[model samples]
Target: METSQTHENSIKLTSTEDGIHLDGSILWLDSKHTGDISFLSNPQSATSKLDSRVIATEETIRILESFRKKPKALICQYNRPFAIGPLNMELLPSGVGLGGASLWVETNNKKILYAPQLQPQNSETCHHMQVRKADILILSAKTPYNADANISRKREKERLIETIKKMVSANERPQIFCEPYATGPEITKILSEEGINVAVHPNLFRILKVYEAYGSHVGSYIQHSIHRGDYDTLLKPIPQNKQLRRVFPKNPVISIEDNQGPRLDDGLFRKIDERFYIPSSCDGRELKTIVPKIKPREIYIFGPYAKDYVRQLRSLAPVVKALFPRHLPSLF
Candidate 1:
């Protein structure tokens, strides 16, 4: 493992085979090393390593339980400090998705914050990301470096609402496809608040209920049924097979997804009348704006465009490192 240091602080960052280690004790992101406790930033981050001693929020554990079996973790709540041996840690909401959290640690009189999946702005289903001044700030560059990175959530929601309304006006039932956890609940809540009746797939409905249980006002939505044609919009998880088309064969469908198109099965793409891209995460521009507020001495970024983000954020912090993950897993 190579170590780097800045003049002001003796903070040492070691990139090991298991994962990045802070001061040779705390690990970030990965949990393969048994010697160090893993701080899972979100439910998706905990999917692969369930047996580890993970520090996550109660909402994160509940969201994980909704899809898979219970995990072995020390459940904590937002803004509450919990002790794990000599270290004191707190879980702060990351605003990336349902139950997404940022890990804040205070050890040896130094503060470290791991916020790899941050949406600092207000979200419909998730808590707004809470950031704190830290000696080291480990952030995420998940949003690509492009024009789409500048799009605001409010604008995206407005466009999505307009698209859905247009589809309804055209007598087409808009069947939107999104990740069950990420944008599905938010989109459902947005449409519901707009007074647009939405019917959700069973998979999405299950996660939506979990969001509502945690005080997210997802509003009213019915489970999609072939016999029920009462909804103006139908929201389903990205189809893995031709099942989506088979279920809504006669209804004129307009497919809506994030920047990444729905990974639909072969030949199933032709059935949709139109498609729209609604971004879920903050863009590079937003990150540039949010990072300065955190006021970290050093910054480490991990995600899709980590290197590019490092260049963009270099001016914000004294030291910026693009610490891309060895293996990038799906956020879902």
Candidate 2:
């Protein structure tokens, strides 16, 4: 389901009685959108080395050819609307890069934020410092922040609170999900009193243990323990890992695992360079400023490259860039 294929392109995902056909760098799929990780379990089969010369023409042709053989219905998600085969693409805020086009939505219903996989420290400014209104912010609040020791100690909770103050109107109310931290718990307790829901998923213990801990918590909001590879960079709570080098701090008393690894870093997002992105969909103009400033070297990772959206980014100017991850570096 994942590939390093990037180009000035349009995607068509068709679902037929047989299976789904993805007409992009990927071709067709013969199953529900269960996800791409399971099929590509082997490192050899899943990973591909891709560069520009082949990106636009050759790679596009190759994947297009692959889909020709599948023969299924087609569906496309562009900007706000989506198209399924012949159906018109509907208009709704869309999410990019975080698996499919669903991430750009936030409903008013009693909702749960399932953020996982990304290192929290890296996005301290983008995720925490910025105010976003969510009924519940299900942070990957794993403790004993050994993986990236520098971030484990960062004042992320305070930043998130400050950001929230900037976002929600004075009358709005929301809650926070957190882990059992000296400060996070206290802050949540205070917020909960003011009508902002502050709750924690005790399952965070699995992330704090000395060993690669495992546990099953049949809870309302979560399922399996988030994988090291799949957690969202903006929402994932920090974990203990090799990023810390030496650990076993006196404060937590958690042990270490020999096979532990660091979260994905700069080297990971480089594969498929996109031209346009939809960060949050609030301000279209601001989104434009975010592009090129962070990682100018990388190609536009879906930066309103299409003739249609490109005009929107320029028109929105500053807000359009707000639709994507503020902290992650640009890719080429």
> Which candidate's lDDT is highest?
1
Model 2 Cα lDDT, one tens digit per residue, 256-313: 1111122322122121111111111212233334333222211112211222233443
Error of 2 at 187 (Å): 9.2
Model 2 misplaced stretches (Cα beyond 4 Å): 1-21, 24-121, 124-200, 207-286, 292-332
Clashes of each: 0, 50
Using TM-score as the measure, the top candidate is 1
What RMSD does each model have against the real structure?
4.2, 21.4
Candidates' C-alpha lDDT = 0.70, 0.23
Work out the TM-score per prediction: 0.83, 0.21
Error of 1 at 277 (Å): 4.1
Whole-model lDDT, model 2: 0.23
